[model samples]
Target: MTGSDAAGRLDDDDFPAYTMGRAAELIGTTPAFLRALGEARLIEPLRSVGGHRRYSRYQLRIAARARDLVDEGMAIEAACKIVILQDQLAEAQRINEEMRGTASQESDLPPG
Candidate 1:
């Protein structure tokens, strides 16, 4: 679904707030599993004012994707590596786009 579709389902305030128990429930996984995912750096939960793990909706979605990958017969280690690579690729793409934008701006500038 698109961002608009998700936005229509819940308010913005709903996105940034979830206890570990609630996050596990929302992702259809166990609390222990969610903790393990955090340990493995699969999903990062926000730290509350009291140092509690406050999982956002995005973290729940990451857990769901990890579950899907594991369910598809991928080894957990491999799935984790794939997720890391995907994040790195996205970052690289963003950097490339920014560089292109800068180059385009320079090209549009008049000669000194």
Candidate 2:
């Protein structure tokens, strides 16, 4: 990729820019914790060409939430499930809002 492209990717939350170690350190967690999250199907870090795991900012946010739940006495598996459900709920809510907006706009139009 070009230098400009690489620079822009740094701002992309979904870009796997952080290495495993850096990701763990940034979140104040351990590499093993990240591995456990991976095993639990929580966050799937991308694999680099050399086989190292790379995490995105978005994944780190999810990891941080999972870690918070764990700190609150939730099991890792349960935390993962909760995070998944939470994500689904957020998406559903967003879609519902969009549909509501569209329906309101349609209602404003005169019937054919």
**TM-score on alpha carbons, each prediction:** 0.72, 0.96
In order, candidate lDDTs are 0.80, 0.97
> Considering only N, C-alpha and C atoms within 3 Å, which residue pairs clash in candidate 2?
none
Q: For candidate 2, lDDT tens digit of each residue in 1-112? A: 9999989999999999999999999999999999999999999999999999999999999999999999999999999999999999999999999999999999999999
Please provide, for model 1 over 1-112, each residue's C-alpha lDDT reduced to its tens digit, 9 standing for 90 to 100.
9999787657654355898888888878788877778788887787788988888777777778887888799877677778878889999999999999999999999999
**Candidate 2 Cα misplacement greater than 4 A, ranges:** none
User: Which regions in candidate 1 have their CA more than 4 angstroms from the true location?
Assistant: 1-16, 46-52
Identify the leading candidate in terms of lDDT: 2
